[model samples]
Target: MTYTSRIDLSDHVRKQACALLQARLSDALDLEAQAKQAHWNVKGPHFLQLHQLFDSVHDEIEQFVDLLAERITTLGHVADGRITTTASATTLYGYPLEATGGEAHLKALAGSLGAFGKAVRVGIDQAGTIGDADTADLFTQISRETDKQLWFLEAHLQAH
Candidate 1:
């Protein structure tokens, strides 16, 4: 008797899922960096609040990054963590770092969350086509979480 394990199923589906994962990892890192930026450089009225919120956002993203990384490795693929790899892999349109005020800072953070949500939605679709239900579920979960942060970040931009 012999025991063997394979990703099984269509190559198209697996390939597509892998591609999505790669992009997701990149997006995750970009968002992570954005959260860090928000934590470090935000100033003005809501500084402490915004700073704490950014840290929370960073922590959640760290969790998701681990989940996605493991899933990638489980599928016989490498999880990219190097700066160069993350820079090239991210589909994100770059989160700005020079925004000094609270409003401007929140506005900038919103863009990264928006991009991450979009990418996760794409990942969900790709996972579905590839019959990777678990991966699809994870993407969906990330999308919802990202949406929450999006709302929170945007809220800071409104006058209160």
Candidate 2:
């Protein structure tokens, strides 16, 4: 698709931004699926709590997915968020299907969120490098929110 924008960014920069956003979209989609997997399969004493937390995390990730998709569209690129595309493009580690315990789910979730947050930090730098402040700020916002979610998941692992 041909994209013409008044955003002042060069074609190369816009393409870069779209690629970056699409990559994050894949990660967000994968993360949401993993959270749902954890929510459904989670068991043990803290099952209810962990199930609820996973749902909440999934919801937040859905919003992030929307943000990323919209950003890609704003750049005039087709946002390829299909499950197949996400499964192929995502950098997230596979969620352990054998993990049924709350602690196990929490550990997996925290690791995924940490990985995502790290990627967002890199995205922020990449957007900045292209002189796309709006995209950089978007990544910054995502990074902060992802870090907060990671903290929430990790808090369950922290000692008193």
Candidate 3:
């Protein structure tokens, strides 16, 4: 698709916004995939609860992916969300394929969510700096939800 947006922001700003959005989109996709990997393979005494929690987190991250993709398109940029694209662009570390225990999966997810949440906060500032309040607000929303999910995941690892 051609860049034909007239959303008041300059082409430069749109290009920058698309870059910011696309980076986070890639991270979000990676996070979702990792969570699903945990969901499907986690096994332990707390397997049922962890499985359910990971599934819920996966669903929420899916929302972030959709929102980001739509925002990129709204800016008249093609959202390059292909797996190959995300795999290359994502900063999230690869989830261990051998990690099948609840504790291991929780640890992996908490770390990834923390990293992703940090990136989203930076994204909010970057978008706002480019005068894209809409994108900034969107990132704010995603950040809030990401933090919540991170809390849920980390809670499982907390020492009583």
Winner by lDDT: 3
What is the full ranking by lDDT, best candidate first? Answer: 3, 2, 1
**Model 2 per-residue lDDT at 10:** 86
- Candidate 2 on 1-160: residue-level lDDT in tens? 7379887788888898888898999999999899899889999998888889899999999999999999998988899989899989999999998987888899998889899999999999999998789999999998999998898898889964
Each model's lDDT: 0.80, 0.90, 0.93
Worst 10 residues of 3 by lDDT: 1-10
lDDT of 1 at 56: 92
Comparing 1 with 3 on lDDT, the higher-scoring candidate is: 3
In model 2, which runs have C-alpha deviations exceeding 4 angstroms? none
> Could you tell me how far off, in angstroms, the CA of residue 15 lies in candidate 2 after the best superposition?
0.5
What does candidate 1's lDDT look like per residue over 47-145, in tens digits? 898889889989988887888877777766677777898988787877675689878778787887888898798889779877988789989998888
Task: Please give the distance, in angstroms, between residue 49's alpha carbon in candidate 3 and its true position after superposition.
Answer: 1.1
Worst 10 residues of 2 by lDDT: 1-10
Model 3 whole-model lDDT (C-alpha atoms): 0.93
- Against the true structure, what is every candidate's RMSD? 3.3, 1.1, 1.0
Per-residue lDDT tens digits of candidate 3, residues 49-145? 8899999999999999999999999999999889999999999999999897888899998989999999999999999999999999999999999
